[model samples]
Structure formats: C-alpha cells, structure tokens
Target chain A: NAGVTQTPKFRILKIGQSMTLQCTQDMNHNYMYWYRQDPGMGLKLIYYSVGAGITDKGEVPNGYNVSRSTTEDFPLRLELAAPSQTSVYFCASSYKSGRSSYNEQFFGPGTRLTVL
Target chain B: AQTVTQSQPEMSVQEAETVTLSCTYDTSESDYYLFWYKQPPSRQMILVIRQEAYKQQNATENRFSVNFQKAAKSFSLKISDSQLGDAAMYFCAYYGKGGATNKLIFGTGTLLAVQP
Candidate 1:
C-alpha cells in the first residue's frame, strides 16, 4: 500500500506565482502536516490539521495555506512564491495523539519547488 | 514552544562501524516524544526510531537504536554496521503529548556519511 503519495515531484515557478502541493495518505491517519526543508536544514512546519476541516497555522505559516477536506488528502498552497519558498516540501501524517503511544509520523516523498 | 537541536552538522563513519548522532531538546512539559528521521538523497523522510518520555527503555529498530536521557533532554541515534546506503540527513523531532494538535518540532539535521 502506498502509505503517503505526493504529486508533482518537482516544480519551478516565478516570483509571485502560486501553486499547490498535493498529498494523500492511505493510512487513515487523523493528523496531517506540511513542512519545508531548506538546504542543509531541518524541516519547518508550515501548516497542520488535526482532522478534516481543522487546519491550523504552524511555526512558519506566513506564505502558505492548507486544507484537510478528507482524511486521505491534505494539500498545501503557496501564494506569491518567493526565493525563500524555494525548498523541498514534505507532508506527514500520524495517528491520534495519546499519552501512552508514540505518535509516529509517516512522511511522503518531498516536493521540490524552486522559485525564481 | 518546544525546540530541538542537532549540534553536529556532518559526521562520517567507516563501513561496518558504528556512529552516534547527538540531539537535544528544550521543553517544559514532562511528557513528550522524541524521534529520529532519515532523509536520503531521494528526499523521503523515513522514521528511524522513536522514544517516549515516560518509557525508561530505549527504542531500537534493527540496526538503529536511540539513547534517551529524559533528565538531560537528550535523544541520540546510534547506527550499527553502517552501510553505504545509510548515508543521509538525520533530523531530531519532538512532540508534546495531549496537545490539541500533536505537531512536531524538528532540529537542524546532521548529515551522516558512510565511507567504504
């Protein structure tokens, strides 16, 4: 089974352009997240959803938007792309949060976006 | 807000040898989770191992093991019998338990190189 699938493995856009990065998971996880990884850097959260229709801003959510319309899909939207937005994007999902369980995040193959 | 830190920017190990990657985190909460994720050249983030704050036993996954020190707030990854395919960027992540959204806080990664 494809645990997580992301579309448009690579894309290039001009400054101010907009695009969407699509992510889908077959694990039926309840939590989904969008993160960007810069060169030689760790991932930074952009947006997240605890469940369908429950999106929230993350640490670095200024230039991005997200929607969780279904348990399987959570898409990330980049509006007015900037040079700083040229990074690899990853989507991850996890099961419900609990005190006794370790919330293991399953990640999709990243989407590489380049803004010029 | 919780924060994760990986002090080593790069580490190299000989084939069949073992290597340890260090990670530290800062958080006021008593219960949380720690994880190590590996991102290879293909840019897919894969879970290497995980540890829960309340668990005294360290987590291990085959060749990968974690040294979890709750008092010092450190979670380190140890890779045994390093293989060429093991070279990747390793990220340390933290998650708080019982949060409305269990979002992960990632550290600046450490690039591990396996030398034959």
Candidate 2:
C-alpha cells in the first residue's frame, strides 16, 4: 500500500498568500488528520476527519481549513499564510475509530512550508 | 483537553548502549492510547511503539520498547543496541478513547543523538 502521501514536499509562501496542502491515503482508512510541527517542538493537531463529508477543528486549526470530500483525500487550506504558520505539515490515517486504544495512525512523509 | 510532555529536549547515547527518553501526559480519561514516533532528517513520522492505557505489560518492538506507567501518567521509550540510524527526534503522543473524532496530542519532542 502507498499508505499516506502528501504533496509539495517543500513550499514557500509570501505573507497573506494562500495555498492547499494535499493529502491522500490508499489504506481506505476512515480517520484522517492534519498536524503541524515547528522546529524544536512536537506536533499540534490542525484538523481531523472521521470519514468523508465529516471534519472537525483541532488544537491549532485557527489558520487552516480542511475538506474531506472523499475517503482518500483530505486537503488543508491556509487562507492567509503567516510566518507563524511556517512549519512541517503531516497527514495521518487510521483504520479504527477514535475511541479504540488499539488504533495505530500511519503518517505521511511531511510537507515543509516556509512563510516569508 | 489532554496534554503530553517530554521533559528532555535533547539526549545522547553511545552506540551499542541504551538510552531512555521520558514522557508524561495529563488526562482524566480512563481509556486512551500512547505512541512514540521517530522523525529522522528525512522528515518521516515513523511509529516506533505503542501502549494501551489498560495494559500493564510493556510493549516492545525489536530494539525499541516502552515503559508505560498508568498511575504516574508516564511513558518512556528505551532504545537498546543504539545505532547511528537511531538518531532522530522522538515524539510522544496521546489518543483519548472512544470518539467520532479521535485526535492525537503530541509533546514538544526529544532529539536523540546516537554517537559512534
């Protein structure tokens, strides 16, 4: 399986510019997530989706928006890129529901974005 | 909201030796999951090990294992037979049990350096 894949391995955006980070999973998982990792920091959840047509905000969803139209795709949109938004972005997917302690989330390679 | 913490910002170990990275989390929920993910220079989030809150037995995968202390809310990763390939940033994450939208909360991360 290709697992989870994210496009644009690296990108640079001017302040106030907008862009979409693409994520797709071939695992047919119902749960997907978006996270941003700053240098010297862990990761902060941006948005998550339980299934197609359903999405929810996460800990750091203020600057981003997400849409899950199909089971394989969940794209994150940065409305107004800021230097504060510059970080490594990751996409993940899990076959199990959120409440299952046995669930394992598979992650993508990550997209590094820089806002200037 | 749950929070994960990694007290050590950086650590070092000699090859063939053992190193432990400490992690603690705060959550009132009785059922949840924990994980340790390794990110090398390639920027890939690789799952090293996982633990269930209800399981008392520790989880091990080859050279990687975890010490999960439910009462103390502590989870630590031990890497035995450390190798240069093991040098990476390790992240501690938490997943609360049973929700339509299960999200993972991550700590600040620990950078491990394996010395030859």
Candidate 3:
C-alpha cells in the first residue's frame, strides 16, 4: 500500500512565485503533517491537520498555508515563495495519538523546492 | 512548549561497528511519545524506532535500540553492526499526550555516515 504520497518531486520557483505541494495517504490516518528540512538542519513543522476539515499551525508556519479538505489529502500552498523557503518538504501521517498509540508517522518522499 | 534537541550534527561509524546518536528533549507533560526517523539520500523520512515516556523498558527494533532516560529527558539511538545502508540523517521527535491534536516537535537532525 502506498502509505503517503507527495507530488512535485522537485521544483524551482522564482521569488514571489506561488505553488502547492500535494500530499495524500492511503493508510486512512487521522493526523497529517507538513515539514521542511534545510541543509544540515532538522525538519521543522510547517502545518498539521488532525482530521478532515481541521488544520493547525506548526512551529514554522510562515510563508505557507494548508488545507485538509479530505481525510486522504493535505495540501500545502506557498503563497509567495522566498529564497528562505527553499528546502526539502515532507508530508507525514499517523493513525493516532497517546503514549501507547503507535504514533509512528509514515512519510512521503520529500518535495525538493528551490526558491530563486 | 515541548522541544527536541539533537546536539550532534554529524556522526560516523566503521562498518560492522556500533554508533550512538544522542537526543534530548524538554516537556512539562509526564506522558508522551518519542520517535527516531531516518532520511536517506532519497529524502524519504522512515521511522526507525519509537519509545513511550512511561515505559521503563527501552524500545528495540532489530539492530536499532534506544537508551531512554526519562529523568534525564534523553533518548539516544544506538545502531549495532552498522551497515552502509544505515547512513542517513536521523531526527528525533516528540509528541504531547494531552492534546486532542497531536503534533510532533522535531530536533535538529544528526547526519550519520557508515564507512566501509
């Protein structure tokens, strides 16, 4: 089963350009997250969705917007791409939450977006 | 706010040897979840292992085990008989137990290299 899928494997956008990174999961998970990894740095959370119709901001939500219209899809939109937004974006999903709740997130092959 | 930290930016180990990647986190909640994810050159984030804050027994997956110290708030990953395939960027993540929407807090990743 395809756990999580992200579109636009790679892209190059000029400053002020706009783009949307698509993410979908077949696992029917309740939690989905978007994160960006910079060179030699850890992944930073950009946004998250608890379930369909529910979305929330994460640690690094600037320059990004997300929509969770369906349980299987969570899309991140870059309204005005900047050089600082150039990074590897990852989408992840998990079944549940809690100390014992697996909480193991299945991640998609990241989208490498370069803002020039 | 909960925060995860990976102090080691890079680490190297000889083939068939063992290497340990350190991780520490801070949170006010007593019950929570911790995880280790590996991102190879492909940029796909893969779950390596997970640990529950309340569990006294450390979690182990094949050759990957965790040294979890609840009091110290440290969760380090130990890879035994390291292989070339194990080379990747490792990230430590945490999730709070009290929230209805569970969100992960990630640490600055540690780059691991296995030398043949």
Candidate 4:
C-alpha cells in the first residue's frame, strides 16, 4: 500500500496567493487530518474529516478550507496566504476510533510551504 | 481543551546509550490516546510508539518504549541503544475520544541528537 501521499514536496507562495495542498491515502482509513508544523515546533491540526462528505475544523483552521469529497482525498485550500502560513504541512490517516483501537496515525511526507 | 507539553527542547545521547524524552499532557477525558512521533530530516512523521489511557502496561516497539503515568498525566519516550539514525525531532500527541474528528493535540517537540 502507498499508505498516505502528499503532492508537491515543497512550495512557495507570495502574499495574497492561493494554493491547495493535496492529500490521498490508499489505506482506506476513515479518519484523515491536516496538520501544520512551524519551525522548531510540533504540529497543530488545521482540519480533519471523519469520512467522505464530513469535514470539521481543528485547533488551527483560520485562512484555510477543506473538503472531503472522497474517502481517499482531503485537500486543504489556503486563501490569501500570508507569511504566517509558512510551515510544513502534513497529511495523516488512521483507523476508526474505538476503545480498543489505538488510532495510530500513518502520516505522509510533509509539504514544506514558504509564504512570502 | 487538551494540551501536550514537551519540556525539553533538545537532548543528546551517546550512540550506545539510552535517553528519555519527557512529555506531559492535560486532558479531561478519561478515554484518550497518546503517541510519540519521530520526524527526521526527511520530514516524515513516523509513529514511534503509542499508549492508551486505559492500558496500564506501557506500549513498546522494539528499542522504543513509553513510560506512561496515568495519574500524573505524563508520557515519556525512551530510546534504548540509540543510533545515529535515531536523531530526529520527537513529538508527543494526545487524542481524546468522542470528538467529531479524532483530533490530536501535539507538544512543541524535542530535538534528539544521537552522537557517536
């Protein structure tokens, strides 16, 4: 299995620019998430989807939007990007939640975004 | 709100020695999950180990193990026989159940350097 895959390993956007970070997982996981990591910091969730057609905001969702039209894809759209958006973005997938399920997340190679 | 904290910003260990990275969390939910992730220079978020709130026996994966203290709300990762390849940024994360999406709260992270 390809597990989780993210497109454009690196990207740079100028102020007011917009771009969509693409994510896909072949593991057929029901839970998917988007997280951003600033330099020298841990990751913070931006958005997540429980299943197709179901998406929700996470801890940090400003300046971003997400849609889960399919189980395998969850793309994050950044509108009018700013310098604060410069960070490494990661896409992750995990199994369904349960008392017995540890929800061990499988992550994709992150996309390093630099917004000028 | 749940929060994960990694007090150590950086830690160094001899190639053959063992080192423990500290992590503490605060959560109101009784049923939740904790995780340790390793991000190498390649920027891949790899799951190092995980522990369930209800499990008394700490989680272990090969040379990696977690010291989970439920009462104290602490979760620490121990790397045994550290090697150069073990050098990476380690993050502690918390996931509470019953959320619309299984959102994970992550710590600021600790950079681990395994010196020869």
Model 3 regions more than 4 Å off: A97-102
Q: Put down candidate 4 lDDT per residue, B9-52, tens digits, no spaces.
A: 99999999999999999988898889998989999988888888
Scanning candidate 1 chain B in windows of ten residues, the lowest lDDT window is B95-104
True contacts kept of each: 0.68, 0.88, 0.60, 0.68
Model 1 off-target regions past 4 Å?
A97-102
Judge candidate 2 at residue B40 and give its lDDT. Answer: 95
TM-score-sorted candidate list, best first:
2, 4, 1, 3
lDDT per residue as tens, model 1, B1-116: 78899999999999999999999999999988899989888998888888889999999999999999999999999999999999999999998885667778889999999999
TM-scores for every candidate against the unseen true structure: 0.94, 0.95, 0.94, 0.95
True contacts kept of 4: 0.68
Give one digit per residue, the lDDT tens place, for model 2 in A1-116.
99999999999999999999999999999989999988899888899998999999988889899999999999999999999999999999988743553467889999999999
Off by over 4 Å in 2: none
Query: For model 4 chain A, where is the 10-residue window of minimal lDDT?
Result: A96-105
Per-residue lDDT over A1-116 for candidate 1, one digit per residue giving the tens place of the 0 to 100 score? 79989999999999999999999999989989898988888888899888899999988999898888899999999888999999999998989755445567888999999999
- Which residue pairs clash in candidate 1? none
Model 1's DockQ? 0.63
**Which 10-residue window in model 4 chain B sums to the lowest lDDT?**
B95-104
What is the C-alpha lDDT profile of model 2 across B1-116, one tens digit per residue? 78999999999999999999999999998988899999999988988998988899999999999999999999999999999999999999998886456677889999999989
The true-versus-predicted C-alpha distance at residue A17 of model 2, in Å, is: 1.3
Alpha carbon lDDT at B9, candidate 2: 96
